[model samples]
Target: MKPWLVVAWKEIFESLRDRRTLLTSLIIAPLLGPVLFSGMMQFTLAKENKDHEQRVEAGVLGADHAPQLLLWLQAQGLKRVPAPATESLVTAAVRNSQPKIVLVIPADYGEQLSAGKPASVKLYVDTSDSDARRAGERLQRLLAGYAAQTAALRLMARGIDPSIIQPVVTDEIDVSTPASRAQALLGVLSYFLLLSTLVGGMYLAIDATAGERERGSLEPLLALPVSRDALVAGKLLATMVFAAASLLLTLVTFIVALRFVPLESIGMSANLGPLVALQLWLSLLPFVPLAAALLTLIASFARSFREAQSWMTGVLLIPTLPIMLAVVAGLKPTSALMAIPSLSQHFLVSRLLRDEAIPLPEMLLSVGGTLTLAALLSALVVALWRHEKLLG
Candidate 1:
């Protein structure tokens, strides 16, 4: 066997024997993202379904003041609840009580309608609570619908076409495919994938460099006849292997978990079946070496295993910053942007999720850029290994 192969096998053997490393690489790191993603999706879908099916209950301050309007509201699906005695009391109740939303019909509401004037009403709601906010929005929609209906009836009474009140109307057209729509919900997937991939190699990186140094094993290993470059290559190769396994497991778990997510409820359909998963896996493969090199380099620079773990943990989140920025800016992929490491993979995975084709040039740029950076970082790790201070 080659010197690098021996070192690689040795590192792999040690990692496999380390139960904590194995657990993280095989189980925790891979499954954590998918489990959390599925839980969030399930909760969001359930809440949306509940919101659509549940009736809105509105407290009316002066139900007697607007019997006709109250009836209209009731007919439109609002269940009127007993309101507090006064508007002040209603506001106070809404601020701190059972009913989260309240409607105050002034004493002149009916008189204003009779006198052909615009009637004003107060709506008290606790906006701090999500459920209350949704309920208040629904009540606002109900009120708006009633007003429109009343306006149309009044226009008809005057022998005028109700459409005359509207000069321009809008019909929103959604051009997104089901798969593309799923990208909205799966926006954070790339972050999770990259993070998990890096995490899979984290313990091994620490073990190879900081842990070995702390155990007084690194000095003896450095004294060996093998070239420092070969040692670095062997260690990074092992890290990449574990990272790749973790990436594959994370991808598979996400695909399986999404099957139960009810994404269709939100007009989304995750295109993460076997075929797409394969495509996504390939698109993200170049990132594995880069992640391994990055993790190993960070760990190699740390003074102790605990310090390496802490530093690597914080450094892992660095790649996610680009993904977050891309999402916030609604950035579209361009050839120039493809030169970025994790950002490029994010763009590629996003395209795959949208069922779009990955341009050949962009794919080359992503792979080339990632591998180039990995090579540079690997050289740095080799140099670090060759340093006399590396024993510390």
Candidate 2:
């Protein structure tokens, strides 16, 4: 057998023999993604159902001035409560009471409507509160409906068609499929999948490098006639294998767990079919070597196993940043993004989840870019191993 292959086989055998390693790297890590994702989705769905079924509570100041408007709000399922005595007290009342929205009808509201003049209503809400925000949106929609009705009545009184005042009618068509619509809900899946690749081979990489040194086995292994590059290549290959396995397990576990998730309850569907799983796995394959090489390089610099583990904890957080930024900034995938390593994998997986076709050029760019990076990092790891301090 080739030296690298022999070393890889030995490492795999050793990792399998250790129950703790197998449990953490293989079983627990893979299962965690699916379990965590499903749990969160379930909780969100429950909260959404509860919110939808509950009535929105609102407070109205100067209710007598806008009796018709207040009645319209009540018809829309807003439970009216006594408003705060002063405008400045609205915020405090909303924060302390169950009312999420307050409508302040001005004292001049009835006078303005009676005189055919424009009047404004003030809406007080705690924008920092999610429930208040939702209530505010509902109130805005109701106010818009009331305004449209009043406008129509005024046009009728003037013997003019209401359509004449509104010259253009806009129609909005949503072309997003259920899978695409679910992208927002499933966006975190990319983070979890990429995280699996980082964590899967972490322990094995640390054990192969710093753990071996701490146990005094690295010096004896380096004493062998095999080239230093071959030794590093062997370890790198083993780490990649474990990482690949972890990525596959994570995908499979998540796909199975998604089957039990009631996605339709949230008006989203995750089509995690076998083909999608295969595509996701293949799309992330190039990243396996990159993750392995990066972990091995970092672990090689550590003086002890615990220190290597500590460094890896922070290193693993790197891949999650791109995903978070993409979510926060609402970033779209472009050809330029494909050149980034972890970010590229995240974009591709997200596209696959959205059931969008990836262009051939984009796929090539991502895969080629990741492999190029892995090759460069592997060379660095080999160069580092050639030094005496690395073995020490």
Candidate 3:
């Protein structure tokens, strides 16, 4: 057998024997995405369903003053409850009563409307309460609708066209399909998918380099006939294998979990079938070698297994930073941006999730750029292994 292959086989065998490493890398890491996504979707769907079924109870402080408005609210299916005497009481009612919103109409509300003057209606709600916030928004829209109708009627009586009062007609048309729209909800899944690659090979990289050195085996192994470059290559190859396996497992788990999620209820669809999973796996392939080489390089500098783990924890954050920035800034993918390694893979995965066709040139640029960087890093790792401090 080739020297590098022999070393890689030894590393893989040792890693598989460690129960802790296998539990974290093979089992927990792969299962994390599916479990997390499923739990979040279930919670969100349950909350939305509960909200839809329950009727909004509105407390009306001066119901007698605005009979017409009360009728309009009733027509919109809002359940009316008798409100308290004062504004302070209305605030208390929102917190204590079943009513999520309290509508306070002034004593002169009817008089002002009859005289064609503006009548003030105040909504008292606990903004901290999500249910109250939603109820308040609905009440605001209902009031606006009533105001517009009244204004149109008044304009008609004055022999003026109501359309003349509005100079512009604005229409907003959404171009996103259900799958594209669902990307917002499933954005975190991309981060986790990319993260699996970094995490899966981390333990093996640390164990092969720092752990072996700490156990006093590295010096004896280095004295062998195999070249330093081959040893590094062997470890790099092992790390890449683990990373690739982790990514593949995560993609498969996501495909299965997505099928059971009630995404259709939220007007979103995730078609992560076998073909999509295959495409995602292909797009992520180059990243495995890149992540492995980078991690192995860092782990090589550590003096002990625990030190390597500490360094890797900080290094793993590097790949996740781009994903965080993309989420916060709502980054759109461009050809130039595809040259960046982790960022490129993230954009490709997002495009796949949205069911958008990736341009051939951009795809080539991402894969080529990542592979080139991986080769450069691997050379650096080889050079580092030749240095005298590598033993210290």
Candidate 4:
């Protein structure tokens, strides 16, 4: 066997023998994302279903002033509750969460309606609260519907055509497919996959370098006849094996876990069938070497296993930063963006999830950019291994 192959086999064998390494690489790292995602989706779906079934209750400060309007609101599933007499009290009640929202009808509201003028009704809600905001939005929609109906009736009573009041009407058309709609919620899958890939290789990377040094085994291994290049190659390759395994398992686990998620309830469906998974795996394959090289490079600098773990924990967040920034900036996949490493993988994975065809040039740029960086980092790792201070 070649020198690098011998070293790689030895490292791989030892990692398999260690229970901690096996547990992390085979189980925890791979399952973490799927389990969390499943639980979150389940909870969110349950809450949304519950919210839909329950009637919205809003406090009314001057219910007597708008009896007809109150009846209309009640018919629309809004339960009217007794509210405070003053606006200040109603605002305080909403802020205190006694009621999520309040509808205040002014004394002249009926008079304004009788005179054919716009009658303003105040809706008090705390915008900072999500539930309150959602409730407020529902109330606004109901109010708008009521206003439109009332306006049309008034036009008919005046012997005028109601449709003439509105010259333009719009029919909304949604062009998004089920898979594309799901991508809006599942875009974070790329971040999870990238993180898992790095994590799977992290223990092995640290074990081969900082761990061995701390255990006093690295010095003996360094004294061998094999060149430093071969030793670094073997270790990096071993790390890549675990990282690749992790990446694959994470994707597979997500596929299985999503099966129980009832995504159809939200009108979204994942396009992660076996063929798509294969495509996704291939597109992400280039990232394995980059993750391995990056982890090994960082671990090689640590003086102890604990120190390496601490450093690599922070290193894991590095890949996520680009994905976060891309989401925040709402960036589209451009040829220039494909030149970025982690960000490129994110875009590619997202495109696959959206059932969109990736341009050949973008694919090439992503693969080329990732592999080039991996090669540079691997060279740097070899240089670090050759240094005398590496023993520390």
Please give the CA lDDT of all the candidate structures. Answer: 0.88, 0.87, 0.86, 0.90
- Clash pairs detected, candidate 3: none
* RMSD of every prediction: 1.9, 2.8, 2.9, 1.9
Candidate 1, 1-392: lDDT as tens digits: 99989888999899999999999997998899999988987887788788986478878888889998888888878887767777767767888845788998889999998777799988888999889999889989888888888889899999999999889988999897877766877878988899899989888888988898899998888888878889889999999999999999999999888888998887777878899888888989999999999999999998899999889868888999888888999999898889999999999998888888888999999999999999999889988888888776
Q: Write the per-residue lDDT of candidate 4 for residues 1-392, one digit (tens) a residue.
A: 99999989999999999999989987999999889988887887787776775467789888899999889888989987767778878888999877888998899999999999999999999999998888888899899989999999999998989999789998999898878877877888888889899989999999999999999999888899989999999999999999999889998999999999988887778878988888888999999999999999999999999999999879999999988999999999888889999999999999889888999999999999999999999999999999999987
Arrange candidates, best lDDT first. Answer: 4, 1, 2, 3
**Candidate 4 clashing pairs, residues 3+ apart or interchain:** none
What TM-score, computed on C-alpha atoms, does each candidate reach? 0.94, 0.89, 0.89, 0.94
**How well is each residue in 269-373 modelled by candidate 2, as lDDT tens digits?**
898998999999999999999999999999999999999999999989988887788778988878887888878888898889988898888899899999999
- C-alpha root-mean-square deviation, candidate 4: 1.9
lDDT of 1 at 365: 95
TM-score comparison, 1 vs 2, better candidate: 1
Error of 1 at 382 (Å): 1.2
Question: What's the lDDT for residue 134 in model 1?
Answer: 91
lDDT, model 1? 0.88
Q: Determine the backbone clash count of candidate 4.
A: 0
